[model samples]
Target: MTAALTVSIVVPILNEADNLPKLFEHLHQLTAKPQQIIIVDGGSIDGSFTLAQSLMTEMITIQQSAIDWQVLASSAGRALQMNRGAALASGDVLLFLHADTKLPNQAMTEIALAITQAKWGRFDVHLDSNKLLLKLVGSMINLRSRLSGIATGDQAIFVRRRIFEQLGGYPNQALMEDVEISKRLKAIGKPACLTSKVITSARRWQQHGTWHTILLMWRLRFDYWRGVSPDSLKRHYYNT
Candidate 1:
């Protein structure tokens, strides 16, 4: 029998203290004690840093070096932070997840099983909302992954460590890194859709309204494919 595969789950966050504990608790309950968890932060002023410090067992901080806040306006993007987490990862498989998302109980097992079969993938997501528009957005996103091999970070991305590094990690742009990386991964190996699902918060849809949020995300994707600057994309990103 081959050795057990270890998955280093990389989660990138900013001021997400309110969501960290629940996320950790859910993750711990889901995956078996397989490998490690690396939480990369973008210099959050909120309690997120302290919360990470508290979960010092599997959870650890990366790049504790201080950062200039204004750099976010320029380079402190999610892609940069996620790459930092990837650098610190030591698992055979790297699973990139969002801090607010919770994977199903079968996550780690399914990942291990899939990777064992020489497959690589991530958990599909079920948006947490009852509204029809939100459900529609969720369906569209999942369908896009199945049809085009592009998945958002919220769905969770798992890849072999060497394969990820060989691809030179996620792009440094503020947006579209997930799409870009998955495109490359698809060319090298098609990513599987795990039977288990992640319950990602639909707060963005709640805040922006389902139709409006979906339209904006699709437009951003189109613009990115057309080579729009991330700065320009984020300038109009819904932060409220």
Candidate 2:
């Protein structure tokens, strides 16, 4: 256990074995130190837990038997998992990271730096797809981050833990939790955007067809804005 900062990095996963090592290494590249790295595993069958154990022995300072790992049955949706992660986090600032996203080396310094200046912030998103349209979409996403302060899960939002608890945390939904919580965060205060962006896999779009996925997401957003339940939205979506 290193000196704890005001920030904690929280991540949730389910059968993401292939990507976990990269995520942990990228977490090393990330900004904050042992701000409590909370890993919420939702019943992985492919030995992802075993890998998390093996990897923890390297970067983390926790005793082998006392690593900050929590395993849940796959019943808790993404929203629930995020909330669980937040509860276990000990930092004043809570960071929500996706399993497939990679952060830059200077992330923690930037995070602490931003905490002094703002209450909340999110990294800009860079998708790992080679498609020209995806590049365009990434530009639009950056623009959205700038204009609306609405960064998706891949972008990773960090906020003071007290503020998160005061605001009642994320809405438990299968989808749209990021958007909903971000709306609340932006309502309380403007969030800072870091130049150190997080890169995400574009496997979902590639598998589902970029245009189709884009259209579906657009529809989901529209429905969410109109107060559709997240569970219903996720029921309609074929996830990543």
What TM-score fits each model? 0.87, 0.88
**For each predicted model, how many residue pairs clash, with residues at least 3 apart or on different chains?**
0, 5
- Clashing residue pairs, backbone N/CA/C < 3 A, model 2: 6-93, 31-107, 31-108, 32-108, 92-161
**Model 2 spans > 4 angstroms off:** 1-4, 29-34, 61-75
lDDT value, candidate 2, whole model: 0.78
lDDT of 2 by residue, 1-240 (tens): 224455677888888899988877766644445456777777788988778767766665533433244433344577778888887777878888889987766676778778777888899888997889998888788887799888788888888899899988888777888888888988988899887777888998888888998899889999988988877888888553
Number of colliding residue pairs in model 1: 0
Position 207, candidate 1: lDDT: 80
Give the best candidate by TM-score: 2
Residue 74 lDDT in candidate 2: 40
Model 1 C-alpha lDDT versus the unseen true structure: 0.74
Q: Using alpha carbons, what is the TM-score of model 2?
A: 0.88
